[model samples]
Target: MRAAELHGQRHVVVNVVDDVPPPKPDEVKIRIGAVALNHIDVWSWRGMAFAKRELPIILGAEAAGEVVDVGDAVEDLFRGDTVAIYGARTCGTCAPCREGRDNFCEGPQAMYGFHIDGFLRTHVNVPARIAVKAPKGLDVMAAACAPITFGTVEHMLFDNAGLKAGETVLVHAGGSGIGTAAIQLAKAVGATVITTVGTAEKAKKAAALGADHVINYREERVEGRVRKITGRRGVDVVFEHVGPATWEGSIMSLKRGGRLVTCGSTTGVAQSTNLYLLFQQQLRLIGSFGCRMQNMRDVMEKMAKGLVAPTIDTVIRLDEIEKGLARLEARDVFGKIVVAL
Candidate 1:
């Protein structure tokens, strides 16, 4: 078996590894087919890990695979089933996990591709409970994004922010992976989407992705445009991810009593907020992390229904991960990138 491992900061190697043994009790052995890249991969490559981790860690967070074997305890699943692996290793006994809020697990945090060996390998074993059956007819590349890209948007917009149809939303970095997913999902639900892009080219792409309005932040005032497009009412929800670079503008673009859901801080994190404005508007700033296992199921349902689709920018082999990571770090992508195993 082959695995892509991070040896050190900015160092990745594709090496042959021993084949994973058959599934243990309550586990499933999978042959990974496709892996999706996220900004977290870039962060790890740049040594921005927020917690303790060992080197030579396998490097892929979102992926879909075929079940080669299932443990004896597993009943509902069988060999040759295609499934999407949830990215995190949550303690199933925790209060939050019991309530279906797996993202808020109380036990030790072991995020795949971050805290432990991940799906970059050809074969791996994971708890059967964490795998969601990929919707029938969903290919490996599309299902690969279910764990992160679409799942995060589903959780942030519907679960956390409570975004409703006909309401307006401001999605920052509309060219990024999650950004593209946000645009399609928001639009699919009949929400008016206002998105910001870094370049003029991406602005056009955002428009094509059902964005009601596109702001080239590099050349225009995004806040001004959002206000004008909404007739000064501002947007009902702000889909924020870029950190300090657009933090103030994201706040300004929201209407009074509006909701803001954030999942990433690709830019620098430090930023100031207006305390008076925050209190005056009764605004809700929700900080969202990864999605629950159910969120992945919800997004996959949408994918199966053709209500939303993954916008893949490119596909790379396992050995070309460095180049893919470099492009992602430089913000030089139009949509999600996948690695085919």
Candidate 2:
């Protein structure tokens, strides 16, 4: 089996290994079909990990594969079943995990491709509990995106922020992976979407993805454009991920009682907020992390039903992982960059 590993800062190499092992009693052996690139991949490549980790780690976080061999204890999965993997290693015995809020697990967690080995290889053993099987005939590349790309948006907008139909939402960085998913999910529920992009090309793409309005942040102010689009009433929710660069603007683009849900900080963290507006308007600022396994199941079901799909920028071979990460870091992609394994 072959694997893509990060040897050092800004150094990625593909290595051939012959020591692949079989699945444990609670795990399954998966033959990876595809992997999706995210900002986390870029951060890891750039040595921006939040925790201390050793070098020469596998370099992928979002992926999907075929179950070639199921453990004896895993009755829910079988050989040749397509499954999307949950990257966070959570302790299933925790209170939050028992309550179906796996993202809030109290036990120590380590993210794949960051603190532990990831799914960039041709074959890897995964815990059956974290592997969510996709619907029959669903695209493997699209399933690879379910764990993070679509699941994260589902958690941020619907689970945490409680986005409802007929509401107006402002999605920042509509050209991003999660941003594109947010637009589609918000529209699927009959919400009016207003998105922000960096280029006119991205603005047009965002509008075509069912956004009611698209604002080029480089040309116009997002808060002003959102206010104008909503007729000065502001939107009901703000799907925020871009960090300090768009934090204040995201808050200003919201309605008096609107909700702002954020999951990432691609533009760097640590931004100030207006305390007066937060109290006077009674705005809710929600910080969201990863999604639960149920979120991945919902996203795959939605994909199977044709409600929403991944907006793939391009598909590259495993050896091209470095290029994909570079594009993500440069913010030069309109959607996900998938690596066909």
Candidate 3:
């Protein structure tokens, strides 16, 4: 088997590995087909991980694979079934896990691709409980994106933010993978989407993705454009993930009593918010992390029907992961970069 391992900061090397062991009674052996690159992969490649982890760790967080073998206890998933592996290592016995809110698991959790070996290998063992089956007609490339790309947006907009159909939303970095998903999802729900992009090309693409308004943050003031587009009323929700660089503007873009949901902070994380505005506006600030496994299932079902799809920037060979990471780190990709295994 072949695997991509991170031995040090900004270093990823391809290495040939021995055969994988058989699956445990509660696990399934998977032959990975595609890996979707996310900002977490870039963070790990840049050694930005806050926790302690061993080097030479396999480095992929989102992926789709075929079941080559299923343990005796795993009856629902069978051999040859395609599935999406959940990104986190959650304890099924915990209260949150039992409630389908796996992201809020009280047990100590280590995220794959950051704190543990990930799915960037030819073969990996997945817990059957966490492997959500992909719809029959969907391809691996699209199914691979369900875990992080689309599922995060589904959890943020619908679950935490409780966004309604008639409201307006401001999505930051509309060119990024999750950003593109946010715009499309908000549009599907009949919301007016206002997004910020860094370049003219991204702005044009964002508009094509059903964004009602696009702001070139590099050339124009983002908050001003958002306010004007909303007719000085401000937006009802802010789909924020860019972190501290855009935090203040995201706050300013939202209407009074509006909701702000965030998942990732690609930029520096520490940012100060005004106490006065928070009290006066009665705004709601919510911090969202990873999505539950059910979120992936819902995302894949939508992909099968073409309701929502990943905006693929390009597909690269397995060994070309470094190129993908570099592209994501530079904020140059307009959409997702998928690795074909």
Task: Check candidate 2 and list the clashing pairs.
Answer: none
Please provide, for model 1 over 168-251, each residue's C-alpha lDDT reduced to its tens digit, 9 standing for 90 to 100. 999999999999999999999899999988888898888998998899888899999899899999999999899999999999
Give the better candidate number (1 or 2) by lDDT: 1
lDDT of 2 by residue, 270-329 (tens): 999999999999999999998999999999999999999999999999988898898899
How many pairs in model 3 have backbone atoms within 3 A of each other, for residues 3 or more apart or on separate chains, i.e. clashes? 0
lDDT of 3 by residue, 145-258 (tens): 988999899999999999999999999999999999999889888999999999999999999989989999999989998888888889899999988999999999889999
- Runs in model 3 lying further than 4 Å from the true structure: none
- For each candidate, what TM-score against the reference? 0.99, 0.98, 0.98
Against the unseen true structure, what C-alpha lDDT does each candidate score? 0.92, 0.91, 0.91
Where in model 1 is the C-alpha error above 4 Å?
none
On the 0 to 100 scale, the lDDT of residue 150 in model 3 is 91
Candidate 1: give its CA RMSD in angstroms.
Answer: 0.8
